[model samples]
Target: MTVQINTDKNVEGHDSMNVYFTEELRTTLARFEDKITRIEVHLRDDNADKSGVEDKRCLIEARPENMQPVAVTNYADTTEKAFHGALDKIKKVLATTFEKQKP
Candidate 1:
C-alpha cells in the first residue's frame, strides 16, 4: 500500500522522518496491504507556535479497496507518541472492519 506523510506549518518534516514513518507504516499494516489502497498520515502541532503538554497531533487515514476511507487521530506530548497512538487506533479499526468480513 502507498503511504504518505503530511505536516502542518507548525511542524517540520524531513526526508529521514518520512522514510522512518513509511517503514513503520508498511510493517505495521503489511497484513492489509492487499486490501488497502493508501494510507495518509497527517501530523500537526495543536498548540501552534507554543509548547504544551500535549500539543502533538497525528491523524491517520486509510483507504481500503471497495470501501469508504477510515481515519483515526491521536494526541500526545511528542510527535512520536502521537504517531504511535494513532497507529494503535487505526490497527483496531482495521481489525474490526476486516473481522466483520469473515465467513
Candidate 2:
C-alpha cells in the first residue's frame, strides 16, 4: 500500500517517522498493508501558540476499494498518542467494513 505522512513541521529523524507509521499501528490492524490502496496521514499541532492538556491532533484517511474512505481523527498530548488513538478508530472501522463484505 502507498503511505503518505504529513507532519506539522520538520521531523528530527526517521525514528519519529517510523513510530508514526509502523510501531504506532502494529497491533491494532490486520493485514491492512496489502489490502489498503492508500493511506493519508495528517499530523498537526492544535493550539500551537497556547498551552493545553491535549493539543496534538492526528487525522488519518484510508481509502479502499468498494467502500467509503475511512477517516479518523484523534487528539492527545503527544503525536504518538494521537496516532495510536486514530489507529484504533480506523481498525474498528475496517473490521466492521470487512465483516459486512464477507459472504
Candidate 3:
C-alpha cells in the first residue's frame, strides 16, 4: 500500500521523520495491505510554540479497495503517540468493516 505523510508547516517534515512514520505505519497496517490502496497521514501541532496537554494531533485516512475511505484522529503529548493512537483506531475500524462484508 502507498503511504503518504503530511505535516503542518510548524512541524518539521524531515527525511528521518518521514522514514520513521512510514515504517511505523507500514508495520502497523501490514495485515490490511492487500485491501488498502493507500494511506494518508496528517500530523499537526495544535499548540505550536506552546506547551499543552494533547497538543499533537494525527489524522489518518485509509483508502480500501472497493470501499469508502475510513479516517481516524487522535491526540497525544507527542507525535509518535498520536500517530500510534490513530493507527490503532483505524485498524479496528477497518477490521470491523471487513468483517461485516464477509459472506
Candidate 4:
C-alpha cells in the first residue's frame, strides 16, 4: 500500500519524519495492506509554538479497494501519540466496516 505523509507549516517536513511515518503506517496497517490502496496521514500542530494538552493532531485517511474510504482523527501532546491513537481508531473502523460487508 502507498503511504503518504503531510505536515503543516508548524510541523517539520523532514526526511526522517517521513521515514518514521512511513514505517509506522506500514507496520501498523500491515493487515489491511491488501485491502487498502493508499493511506494519507496529515500531521498538524494546532497550537503552533504554544504547548497544550492535545495540540498535536493526526488525521489519517485510508482508501480501501472497491470500498469507501475511511478516516479518523486523533489529538495528543506528541505526534507519535496522535498517530498511534488515530491508527487504532482506523483499525477498529476498518474492521467493523469489512465485517459488515462480509457475506
Candidate 5:
C-alpha cells in the first residue's frame, strides 16, 4: 500500500521523516497490505511548544478499492501513542465495513 504523511505547521518536511512514518505504518498493518490502496496520516501539534497531556493529534485514512475510505483520529502525548490509538479505531471501522460487504 502507498503511504503519505503530512504534518501541520509545527513540523518540517523531511525525507527521513517520511521514510520513518511509512516504515512504521507498513510494520503495523502488514496484514492489510493487499487490500489497502493508500493510507494517509496527518499529524498536528495542538500547542507548538507546550508539553502536557495529549497534545498531539494523529489522523489516519485508509482507502480500499471499491469501498469508502475508513478514517480515524486520536490525541495523545506523542505521535506513537496517537497513531496506535487511531489505528485501533480504524481497525474497528474496517471490521464493521467488511462485515457489511460480506455475503
Candidate 6:
C-alpha cells in the first residue's frame, strides 16, 4: 500500500520523521495492504503559535481499494503522541470495518 504524509506550516515535518512513520505505517497496516490503495497522514498544530494542552493534531485517512475512505483524528501534547493515538484509533476502526464483512 502507498502511504503519504502532509503537514501544515506549524509542523516541522522533517524527513527523518516521515521516513520513520512511513515505515511504521507500512508495518502496522500490512494486513490490509491488498485492500487499501493509499493512506494519508495529516499533522498540524491546533494552537499555531501558542503552546497548549493537546495542541498537536493528527488525522489519518485510509482509502480502501473499492470503498469510501475512512478517517480518524487524535490530539495530544506532542506530535508523536498525537500521531500514534490516531494510528491506534484507525487500526481499531479498520479492524471493525473489515470484520463486519466477514461471513
Q: Compute each candidate's TM-score over C-alphas.
A: 0.97, 0.80, 0.95, 0.93, 0.82, 0.97
lDDT of 2 by residue, 53-76 (tens): 778888988888766798999999
Q: Which of 1 and 4 is ahead in TM-score?
A: 1
> What pairs collide in candidate 1?
none
Whole-model alpha-carbon lDDT for candidate 3: 0.93
Prediction 1 global C-alpha lDDT: 0.95
Selected candidate, larger lDDT, 2 vs 4: 4
**Pairs with backbone N, CA or C atoms under 3 Å apart (clashes), candidate 6:** none
Runs in model 5 lying further than 4 Å from the true structure: 12-16
- Model 4 stretches with alpha carbons more than 4 Å out: none
User: Could you tell me the lDDT of residue 100 within candidate 4?
Assistant: 90
Query: How close is each model in CA RMSD to the real structure?
Result: 0.7, 2.5, 0.9, 1.0, 1.9, 0.7
Q: In model 5, which range of ten residues has the least summed lDDT?
A: 9-18
How displaced is residue 77 in candidate 2, in Å?
0.7
In the predicted model 2, the residue pairs found to clash are: none
Strongest candidate by lDDT: 1
Error of 6 at 3 (Å): 0.6
How much lDDT does each candidate structure score? Answer: 0.95, 0.76, 0.93, 0.92, 0.84, 0.94
Model 5 Cα lDDT, one tens digit per residue, 4-97: 9999887565888788778888887787787889999999889888887998899999998877888999999987788789878877777687
Candidate 6's C-alpha lDDT? 0.94
* Residue-level lDDT for 27 in candidate 2: 44
Candidate 5 TM-score over all chains jointly: 0.82
Q: Across residues 2-101, which tens digit of lDDT does each residue of candidate 1 receive?
A: 8999999988899999999999999998999999999999999989988899899999999999999999999999999999999999999999999998
Candidate 1 colliding pairs, count: 0
Decide which is better by TM-score, 1 or 5.
1
Model 4, residue 28: displacement in angstroms? 1.7
